[model samples]
Target: MATEHGIPKLRIVEPSFDSPLTSVIIDLEKLRDNRLDSKTHPGIFFQIKHIFQLLESLGSARIEGNNTTIAELVEKEISGSRNDDEIIGDDEINEIRNAERAMDFIESRIKNNSKIDQAFILNLHKIVVE
Candidate 1:
């Protein structure tokens, strides 16, 4: 740590060359590669992946205090239909839809072998934000 012009600057810690965590990282990578081979079972993998994306979208909405449920989200996603009895707001529904579309874009890019660079991320962010 150092001070410059009466402002304290924190020291940055550099990572070590080797550590016990390296083995864990390697094992996790192997597991990920083995299990995430969508080519092996494209149909089931995409279905499960879509479910996970929906759950992730739901979690994001919940973090923002949106009370939209998975069932409601799926119903809206499937048919764009909303029940008159349900009092969910348009903002909540839109947030869920935005996340779903963002995830879909990412999936599409991956399927198309598109590079996940800064430009790609910015494009995805644009889709999600607007």
Candidate 2:
């Protein structure tokens, strides 16, 4: 049913196993369960995770019109040089950094058994904005 503002209210419904969508979901779950384990070392795993997080952050920034490229970001990271003559602006860099920080906050706060609630979402939003 629509609200007074004419926006339809969302309703939660139970999943039906006989639906085609349900079969696709089951197939995806099976694929996830059968995926091969990398068995990577903890140190290596962290390194990989950091790389992926950086990529995710950069992608987020790009979506928001931050024109920083992955190569430029990686160069800045590796060189550790924050000179005045840098190709990318500080704002762009900060946008990406903020996204990365938000991702880290999510990782730190969430776990396998954790329930994501409104408070957690608001806190996460604060982190991204601040």
TM-score of each: 0.61, 0.69
Tens digit of per-residue lDDT, candidate 2, span 25-127:
8889889768567879879998998899999999988988889998888887888764433434478887777778788778877745456776888888886
lDDT score, candidate 2, position 61:
86
Task: State residue 114's C-alpha deviation in candidate 2, in Å.
Answer: 3.4
Residue 24 displacement in candidate 1 (angstroms): 3.2
Provide the overall lDDT of each model, using Cα atoms, as 2-decimal numbers. 0.77, 0.78
Clashing pairs in 2: none
Cα deviation of 51, candidate 1, in Å: 2.4
Top model number, TM-score: 2
- TM-score (C-alpha) between model 2 and the true structure: 0.69
TM-score of 1: 0.61
lDDT of 1: 0.77
